[model samples]
Target: MRRPHPASRPAPQLRIKPPRQLIAESGADLEGHGLRRTMGLFQLVCFGVGAIVGTGIFVGLSDSVAKAGPAVVLSFALAAVTCVFTAFSFAELGGAIPVSGSSYSFAYATLGERTAFLVGWCLLLEYGVSVSAVAVGWSQYLNELLNSLVGWQLPDALSAGPGDGGVVNLPAVVVILLAATLLVRGVRESARATAAMAVLKIGILLLFLAIAFTAFQAGHLSPFATHGAGGVTAGASLAFFSYIGFDAITTAGEEVKNPRKNVPIAIMICIGLVTLLYCAVAVAAIGGLGADAVGDKPAALSLIVNQVTDSTVGGGVIAFGAVVAIASVVLAVMYGQTRILMSMSRDGLVPRVFERVSPKTATPAVNTWIVALVFAVPAAFASLDAVVNLTTIGTLAVMAVVNVAVVALRRSEPELKRSFRVPLYPASPILGVGFCLYLMYGTGWATWLQFAAFLVVGSLVYACYGRSRSRLVAPAAPGA
Candidate 1:
């Protein structure tokens, strides 16, 4: 056979989705394939808030406090800074692309299809497992509320997971199913419910601040940096989990009205509001009760409120608020997971069932149910401690990818019309990636191993299934 000249051969092509195509497809109503745009700025902001203000503040605070003492406030600030950098990247790409896949779409547009599939895989860990973790936290507060109001609570056999000496976490399973039901109804209905819950939870946190501050003592903060810089950094790693939901805002790009403008603005607003609230709550909790008392206590805020006011009524109110707060997180995060899967399915990276939208609801009804049931098993039997670190590491890994995607997109498509831009260009995104790695470093080695194992499975699945089925490689079949 005659050898062909190297220069005459064609360059290998990469499977990258065009940014314009993503935007155009988002607006097209393809029979049962399109999602309705019903959320305005307020609803979008509420959705972000609902997702961001859950178990981290309500239950995980104790773990942070145990590590950093009074300096947990600094930990919150550190995590906020990390999120701010990534949120800027998300805002820019979300405005330009405005698709349902969030970081997965960003990756597909800037990086190649294989990278996008991996990013989507990480998101499954982030949103789906986080829902289970938050549900477990919700069960804790539910018990607190029940005991406070009725002087009775579910027994250990019914209230906790197997890891926690219970047969199943019934409340966790029930809450997840309820959230799935609400999501199947429609985005508008879910938005309204989330908004109402957002307002109620915010008010409850404010009330906690008021009562907690009444007992605030400077003496409580005397030894602020008790465990030093390493402790604060580790606490910040855990605190990063609290900021996970802000990016969930980008996941709603296809379902938000005027997403190009509203998505970016809502992201900025959500981050600023949630950051302030988190720092304030951290300060109030530490100041009201000395660091020693706050450490390693489950439902720390409610417990602090009870102690500060010397009454169970105050604690009960906060507990009830926590139950509401955590439930909203489950709803919002589950919604995000379904949308990401829907986007992946449309690209043929996953099963087609995920992409199917219900004609009557304008929602991925079957997909939502599948997500709920899949995660409910873990919520029923897995321990909260077992899932929290996995979720945090997965979330950090996904955010790092998004930051890299921002830099890549800027270089590849400088002319891309962006409604919002990262302030420092490459520097902002570079720092975002750095911060993510820094936090990931602070996590335990066991978590890194788990994340690594997850990636291996994801890569294998992509090689065996997604790679061959991807639409970029071959057009979808008729009616598919």
Candidate 2:
């Protein structure tokens, strides 16, 4: 066979498709989905809260407190402000696109297939490690709850992962499987379960607040900014972890009822609820327990509850709540992972099996199970410390891209209907991207290198498979 000239060779799939094409595909293909759009504002808000309120408040507060002392409360405010700019960008994009895949979908419609592939790849790391990390946190609290309530605890061999001197973190795997099973059942049931858990979780935090304030001494907050402005910004960077779940709302657009209007509503509602809850919890814990005492504690919230009440029962209840709260995180993270894969697969970026939704459950059965198994290994055997940092990087990067997507779509498709438009035109998204980049810089260069390596691998995969199989062909198929 004669060798083809370089110019004669078919170019890779890099051309951007018209936004209308993607919109039309959605209109036609979505009608055939097993995915029912039954998720309302409350369920959406619950999903965001369920995902947001747990990991940071329970375990991450210790590190934040150590960095910024009582000023960690201000740290939450700083993070929230950063989140607000990004949230506006998300609201605008989610309202206009009203599709799945989150930034990946939005980026595809605006930035081109290559950039979307990279965004989806980043999300894989973010969601997978996040689920595993939440599972690990749940296991720790579950063990604490057992010891606190029943005066019994699991052996290190069964309770701790290898990173902490154990054969396997069996509890982590169990929790991941449980969350996956719930997700496989369907979104409505999952949302309802999430709402119930959110209520219980909020109740526990409220109880802690009430108890903490009884013993609150202004003296505890003396010398509040121990480490100064640098420390506060560092704490904000770390505290930003809790805000990742608001983006989880963007992933549920297709399943949300009235997504164009409701997605933005849910995003803002979730942001407000999360910011308030986080600030309250941080202040209460620090006010009652003192920053020095709580700074190094692993189960810091429970310890604060114990110190305030001077009873194991009080601590035990808090521990029980921590378990439920982290369980919700596991559920939301796993749910986000499966949905992103479904979106990518539908675009022919992954195996088609991923996009297959179960008619019986109206969920992506195989995708959910696969996501559970993938994260369960890490939860059971690996140290998630390094992997967890990658989620922060991935999240910041994706949020920046989503902001840019809003700008690009505005310029490219001016006539397109947008239920929510970002205020202040280019400035909002520009500021959103700028803030995200600032945070990404704080995540350290090591994480940046890892993110770059991740994109390199994803690009290789795209060249080998995604470009060849991508459904952006003539005579567009449903959701192509």
RMSD of each: 1.8, 3.1
Cα shift from native, residue 234, model 2 (Å): 2.1
The digit string of per-residue lDDT tens for model 1 on 22-134 reads 77666622221478778899999999999989999999998898989899999999999999999999999999888888999999999999899999999988899999999
How do all models score by TM-score?
0.97, 0.94
Candidate 2 differs from the real structure by a C-alpha RMSD in angstroms, to one decimal, of 3.1
lDDT, candidate 2, at 363: 92
lDDT of 2: 0.85
Off by over 4 Å in 2: 1-14, 28-32, 474-480
Candidate 2 per-residue C-alpha lDDT over 1-480 given as tens digits, one digit per residue, 9 for 90 to 100 = 999999999987555756556656555226424578878988889998998888778877887888899999988898888899889988988887777777788899899988998889889877888888878778889988999978999998998787888889999999999999999988889999999999899899899888888878889898989999888877877788877777888888778888888899999998998889899888888888899987988788888788778888899999999999999989997898888898888778899889888989889999999999988998998654546678888888888898898889989899988888888988888998888887777677888898899889999999999888888752336564
